[model samples]
Target chain A: MSFSVDTGEIFGYLGPNGAGKTTTLRVLLGLLSPTSGTAIVLDADLSKDDSMRRRVGVLMENNGLYDRLTARENLEYYARLYEVNRPGNRVTELLDFVGLTERAGDMVGNFSTGMKRKLGIARAILHEPEILFLDEPTSGLDPEAQHMVRELILRLSRVESMTVFLNSHNLDEVQRICSRVAILHQGRIRALDSIQHLTSAGKKTGFSITLADTTQASEAEDLLSSFGGIGEITRNGNVLGMMLVTIHAHEVVTTLVKNGIWVEEARIQKRSLEEIYLDVMRQAEGDVA
Target chain B: MSRIMVVAEKEVRQLIKSRNVMLSALLFVGVFGIFTVPAVLSGMGDTGAMMDTLGFYLVLTLGVFMGYLFTAQVFLREKQSGVIETLLCTPLSLRELWFGKVLGVTIPGAILAYFSAILIMVTGSAFTGQTLVPSLPVLFHIIVVIPAFIAATSGLIGFTQFILGMRENQILNFVIIFGIIFLTTFIRELTGPEFSVTWTVVAAAFGLALLLILVTAWLTRFLSRERIITTLSE
Candidate 1:
């Protein structure tokens, strides 16, 4: 049992293309039975307790949609399969959410790739599932469609507090949206952590002092770099950036004022998610090699 | 329960859209109408010789072609289109999927077979110059045996479709359709002549149908995200 996720989360499962993301989704959806390990979904082992799938939703990368059926019909078919409580209302809501209310009558075969994917999402969430497994939620989609999908997911996550297990190779998307991320490389988790703790590694914990002019910035940089605790001081435009490698960040006020550089603003460089993801993958590759 | 039916119904609807299947069904029915129906009507002809020589030729050649297409392309289309990936991630088991597919083809195939049989009877009667009313037993045989033939053929088709990966290459599908036809005859001979073609086919159909159900159940034991992921990573 997981110690966390009880409070709800959008956990991103990051990996390269063809990294078994689809296969993992299959197992979660109970389409495929695992040979050895126990599959626990929604606190129940899928192998033993088959009923758990009823509470879970899955949007696989490929839509096994009935191409002959209209979009509305496709959703209706899945809605019945998932045993949705309010079939008509759910269908309407899903169609509207996916922005397919206009094309509800069109056959799935006629819908564009993105439209089909949106329909897939609608089908996945129609059952009001407690958990959703979305494999590459925005892959192959246009930028506009990608934004729509992202916004919809954020809305759903915030409002429903739904546990979303998103699998994707898009690192940027993962970094921007995921509250927590797990990197899977070659059938194992390379790393799993929150965004904040991951990027704060091997860096001076100090604030930057913003000056009004580049002349002030260069002077400040020279003065700060000379100080004993300040390791490396650089000037970015009017900003005096210093890496106080040894001293605590709180000591910046005293160090700056003593150096005669009046500080207008103080801030630290926050690490980006891409930086952490690359670091973890590099570590994993090194360890494996 | 409802999901399986939805899947099966959708498959049936797709049949209407397939120009290839429609053309194949029409060609097969037309051949039945042209050759056998005429021969049966001409009772002046030798019935035994026809059943022995021409009938076997027809059933083996055309039946195999039809059977192969029924099994191979039916599911292969969905697989190639990447649709199988969608439903496989559902709560549905493989057993239900197989049944839905079998029915999807069997219903339409059976209807086609039934009409072909009607042409056979009408032509046979006209040729014989007598009321060739089949007895109740024969009628029962026709009803039971004909559907069984189609069902069994569809089952055989399903196995080949799965084994051959019929979805991608149309050339492979042609090779498989003919290959299974020849193999069915070979497998039949190995089982022995005491079981005639009808019995052999019937038994084989029913038996293979049962085997398909089992294979599906067993294969599912290893299916999961691991399989897809492992495959992709490789």
Candidate 2:
């Protein structure tokens, strides 16, 4: 329910459907007033200072574009609204940045969903705002387009030193681009931390080793069962997958080989952001129950 | 350009591109301007006064109707499309948005009103077998008072569109359309053959329109970004 994104940080607001992600963004952008408390941005309450909005850029679910207007006109209109210096040049620069310069004169009504989404992002950063708020920025985009948007967000943060507030349900996208994230469920924040800390926090690494012999698989499991630093050793056919708490994959292989068990293949499996996110949601749900 | 002019210029361009609304405004003016001239000529003892009164009130009436038609395109369409949500985030205040739209609707509405005046002059001369030009007062009314009335009416209607919900706005539109038609016809019937168009009447009408503009501009204080954003279509 509450967090602060540091300057030049790509803060991901991750949540399930109806988790108040969009509502939080709206409150911060001054589209909706908070019921009891205030939401501030840029050292000023957005609801109180109208001029502060000029410093922020927003791209909502609707993209805030006119279909009747051409792609060039759409960006030009916003450029003028934000009062970007040399609006004509900025519009052309953005069109090239989003790779829509070829279709600049085409009506936005005829644009595909991905094209429109790209244009929406172009419009959001038209003025090179200090902070950008994007809601599901990559929703309905193809893999290539999604990658392009992620790269653009990274470039904006690294090159422009612009802070980004991204609201998305795409955990993989968040994992790739967001430096930190807050997972919300049922109108409350269940977890908030850096990607590195949350993914590595208290979770043991997993490994699956393929034994050369079916008979050695059970022996491998039995040996690892009493192992001091390993947990949850399971055997399926010739494969032994287990959780490694303190032992390394190399140590597990050496221990098996020293016991006369031939190890065919050993692979390490790290916990993903998706697993952490789902686990947090389940715990939050259990608390409510 | 100033933010108000930016918004106003965009509205004007977009409304001009809206073919259906433009054709309807032109059709409304053409039909009433050409057909009603004969009706006024049939009931008049003084042809000049009859032409003058028709020019004065009819232009204002048509101007208001045109404003009504264009207001929906400028105000309601933006809300329905949910574009106003982003606009609310801009540096422009609510008053600037309202005034810009009022200016946008007035430009086209006044142009159509001027066309209607010319149609009346042509059709009235044809019907009476003599040319009739409106007096100086009537000319002033057509040029000045009609555009001011158009701006006033557009501002009021656009304000109501922003404040009210969708279903309530639909009902309000019906009431406004019928009210404008009834008032235009009722005022003509009330004038009868003894009515005289004077400088005082022209000045009084301009004064009333100016008052309406000021009142509507002041009432924009009640409009909030939250209200418009919440009322916007999802």
Candidate 3:
């Protein structure tokens, strides 16, 4: 329900539909007043201070574009609203950045959804705001377009040094780009931590081993099942996948080789963001029940 | 001031680019301006007086109608499309946005009103053997007072649209259309053909328009970002 984004951090907000993600975003952007709590950004209340909004940029689900206007014109309109200096150059630079330079003069209504989203991103960052809030930025985009958007978000954080609060259902995108994330379920934050800590939070480590043949994998699985600290062992062809609780990867590899089970490869898998998100949702639902 | 101008400028540009709306407005004015002049003139005894009367009431009606048409586009269209949420995030104050849109609607509405005046005059002159020109007061009304009325009308409509929900706005829109029609008929009946255009009448209309504008501007204090944003989904 409450959190703060550090400067220049790409904080991902993950939630399912109807989890009040957009509602929280609206309150923070000053489009809606909170009923009982404060939503602050940059040490100023955006709802009260008009000047403070000049330093912030936002791209909501709608993209806030005039379809009648050209792509360049849409950016220029926002650029002027933000009082950005040299709006012409700034707009052109952003058009290139979002890869819409060739279509700058074309009407936005004619653009594809990906093109519109790209143009929306360019419009949001045209003024070089200190912070940018993007709601479902890559929703409905193709894989290639999604990659471009994720890369762009990273570049904005790393190059422009702009703090980003990204709200998305794309867990892979968040895992690939965000430094920290908060998972919201039924209007409450169930999990909030860095990607590293959250993925490695539990004691059980996912470990996988590939052997030379199916017979060797079967033998290894049986051997590992007999041992303590290893559970949920499943064998497919020459690979043995399991979760290591009290055991270590080095011990497993040494034991396998000593037992004459040839080890082709061994990998320690980290928990994915999708797994963490589902866990949080399950816990929240359990609490509700 | 600059931000207000920016918003105003964007609205004007969008209005101009709306080809279908522009064409419909032109057709509406053309029908009333050209087709109705002969019938109204034939019923009046004084040609100059008839020209003044037509220029006065007809142009003012057309101007306010233009305000109505364009206010929906400039004000309600943004709300309907959810772009107003983003605009609210800008540094522009609520008054500035309302005023900017008012000016945006007024400029084009006044221009159309001027065109209507010329069409009425030209059509009346063609029907009659003599050149028909409005008197000094009527010209002043066309040049000055009509735009003020347009601003006033659009300003009030835009303000209501910002504060009201979609269903209420739809109802309000119906009221506006019928109200404009009723006012036009009522004023025509009240004035009769004996009504004359005078400096006093023009000044009084101008005063009323200015008052409406001031009142609308004052009413904007009640506008809140939360109110506008909350109504957007509806």
Candidate 4:
């Protein structure tokens, strides 16, 4: 329910459809007043301090654009609102940055969803705000466009030293870019931790091994079945997959080789962010039930 | 430029580019300005007095109607599309934003009102076979008082749009359109053939307009970012 993002960290907020992610975002952006607690950004209450909003930028799901205006005009209008220095130059630079230079004169109503999202990002950081908040940044984008957006977010955080608070349902996107995350359910944070810790710090490590032939796979399966600290063993053709509870991947491979089973490949698999997120959601649902 | 002026400038530009709206506004003013002169002259007595009366009530009515039309575009459209939410996140205060949009709507509404006034004068002169000029008081009403009234009317409507939800605004829009039509008809009935434009009438109208503006500006204190935002979804 309560947490703080570090100065320049990329914090991911994950939740289901009705988990109040947007309500929290609205409160943070000063659009909605929180009922009980305070939502502060950059050490200032955005609702109370008008000037402090100048240092923060946001791109909600709507993209906040006027369809009647050209792409350039939309950015220029926001640029003037922020009082950015040399708004013309800044707008041009951003149009180029978001790869909308050729379409600058075209009305945004004619633009694709991806194009609008790109322009929205450019508008958000037009003033070089200290922190940026993006809600569903790559929601409707194609794979290539999604990749470009992900790369842009990473570049902004690393090069501009701008803190990012990304609210997204794209687990793969978050796992690729975000350093830490908070999973919220039913208006409360169910799990909050670094991606590294959540994926690897569990008691069981997912380990997989592929043998050279079906005969060798059968021997390895038999060997792993009799071995302690290994459970849930499943096989398909020459591949063996199981959960390693009390033993390490190296020890498993060493034992197989000692048993004269030719091990073609033995790999340690880290649990994915999607798995961790689903586990958290299930736990929360179980608690409610 | 100040942020208020910036917002006003963008709004003006957008209104200008809205060709359909501009065309419709021009059509409304053109039809009323040209058609009303013959009816007024045929039923009235004094030529100059009739011209002055036409200038006073018609131009004021046109200005107010223009304000009503553009206020929906300048204020309600943004709220409906959720662009206002982004504007609220900026450093500009709610008062400044409301004032800026009022100015934006007022400028265009007044310009259209001016066009309607000139059209009325030209059409009247062509029909009467003599150059007709409004009295000094009527001239003051068209040149100065009309724009002030436009600003006041648009400011009040824009304020209401910012505070009310979509369904309420839709209902308000219908009420306003009907009310303007009824007021126009009522003005025609009240101004008999013997009625004359005088300094007293001009001064009283100007005072009323100034009062409306001050009242609208005072009413803006009740506007809040939360109210505007929460109504966006509705």
Candidate 4 residue pairs in clash (backbone atoms < 3 Å): none
- What TM-score results for chain B in every one of the models? 0.65, 0.96, 0.98, 0.98
- Candidate 2, residue B58: lDDT: 83
lDDT per residue for candidate 3 within B3-117, as digits (tens), equals 8899889999999999988998899999989987888888989999989988989999999999999999999999999988888888888988998899899999999999999
Q: Which portions of model 2 show Cα errors greater than 4 Å?
A: A211-216, A260-265
Candidate 2's docking class is: medium
Model 2 vs. true fold: TM = 0.94
Docking quality level of the chain pair in candidate 3: high
**Model 3, residue pairs in steric clash:** none
Candidate 2 structure lDDT: 0.89
Which of the two, 2 or 4, has more lDDT?
A: 4
| Local accuracy of candidate 2 as per-residue lDDT tens digits, B88-143 | 88887888889888998998888899999999999988888889999999999999
lDDT per residue for candidate 1 within B98-139, as digits (tens), equals 667777776777666555555555665566565445444334
Q: Could you tell me the lDDT of residue A230 within candidate 2?
A: 90
Over A72-157, each residue of candidate 4 has an lDDT whose tens digit, in order, gives 99999999899999999999999999999999999999999999999999999999999999999999899998998998999999
Residue-level lDDT of model 3, residues A1-289, one tens digit each, is 7898999999999999999888889999888888888999999889889999988999999889999999999999999888899999999899999989999999999999999999989988887889999999999999998988989999999999999999989899899999999999888888889999999889999999989766777778888889999979987888889999999999999999999999999999999999999988988999999
Give per-residue CA lDDT, model 4, range B1-234, as digits (tens): 888899899889999999999999999999999999998888776789889989999998999999999999999999998888888888999988998999999999999999999999999999999899999999999999999999999999999999999999999999999989998888777677767778898898899999999999999999999999888863
| Reference-based lDDT, each prediction | 0.65, 0.89, 0.92, 0.92
Runs of candidate 4 exceeding 4 Å displacement: none
- Alpha-carbon deviation at A271 in model 2, angstroms: 2.7
Write the residue-wise lDDT of candidate 1 on A1-289 in tens digits: 1223443688888876655565566666555665567556777766454456677777777765777778988888777767788888889988998799999999888988889888888888888888888888899999888888888788779998888888998887777777887777766677778755666766665457787555667677666666677766766788766676777766766666676767777788766767767777788789989
lDDT of 2 at A35: 81
Candidate 4 has what TM-score? Answer: 0.98
